[model samples]
Target: MKNYLILAAGLAFAAPAATAQSTASATGAAAAPISAGQRKAAEELLAATDSEKNLSATIDRMLSAQLEQNPGMKAVEPEMRAYLTKYMSWPSMKEDMVQLYAREFTEKELRELTKFYQTPTGRKTITKMPELMAAGMEIGQKRMQEHLPELQQAIAEKLKSQPPGAVK
Candidate 1:
């Protein structure tokens, strides 16, 4: 259950980034030409975002909070520790996500995107995205809670309809 919640949280956070990447791709075809200075500015903004650092911090915080919420998780601490060790050791996950973005946009397209993001308007959007995502997740959680009872009841009824001693 905790794992599922963590996965949900991750997806929720990633959605905005995914949207940004898609938008970059979609607008790539006819984007306004960017100057060299603009490209450099965008690169600086990207560096400042420090995606890997942010992701690592978020993961650490989430895992710590999960362990606190579920003391039984202590029994699986070794597994969790091993998983985090492996995950953190792989520098490729962030690269892979970036590569996906790269694949979606040409080099010129990426430069233009970087240029736009470096601007005040773009910077503001980037800064507010995390908070926007958190709000989205809150809304999602409320909707899930609203439907949970009905979902549980449906599952219970379906299970009850099954034959006794049947392999699930």
Candidate 2:
């Protein structure tokens, strides 16, 4: 149950953007405040990319995939959907997402990205991202499953080498 909830939250919040992590300080002490122009550019970029539609599609795909993998979860599917839609829908998250982009990117960068997203290639990227992400995840899962035994073995070896209670 906890895992499902976590998965739901992760899926709902996952941005299908550049897939890069921010290098900002953990405490955000080094972060600069977002300017109004930056925020506006972020909003325009999101609009050009149809982020809301992509978000909805991503959530639907994630839920359907989860249900397919765990038939027993079907009973709670409606609740899961409702919870995600109520709390994490595009309307609810748009401002925060805009802030995120605004903080991570400069106003000029955002404007350039917005322009790119208005082009044919950029439009294709937006439309194809959900499917591309799904395929990428499938590949990653397959690779992880294949190597899981090696990871387990490495952990077991490290634990054996450690002094008793040292890990704690």
- Per-residue CA lDDT of model 2 for 64-116, tens digit only, reads 87888888999998898898898768988787678778877899999999999
Q: Stretches of candidate 2 above 4 Å error?
A: 17-25, 30-32
lDDT values, one for every candidate: 0.61, 0.80
Considering every candidate listed, which one attains the maximal lDDT?
Answer: 2
Clashes of each: 0, 0
lDDT, candidate 1, 1-168, per-residue tens: 667357445533453266665565567755455455544444444454555655565556656767787877778767775666565422635543554444455566667667777788877876776667668878999999999999999988988988987637
Best candidate per TM-score, number?
2
Q: What is the TM-score of each candidate against the true structure?
A: 0.58, 0.86
Candidate 1 residues lying further than 4 Å off, grouped into runs, are: 1-48, 71-82, 88-90, 153-168
Cα lDDT for residue 44, candidate 1: 46
Model 1 earns a TM-score of 0.58
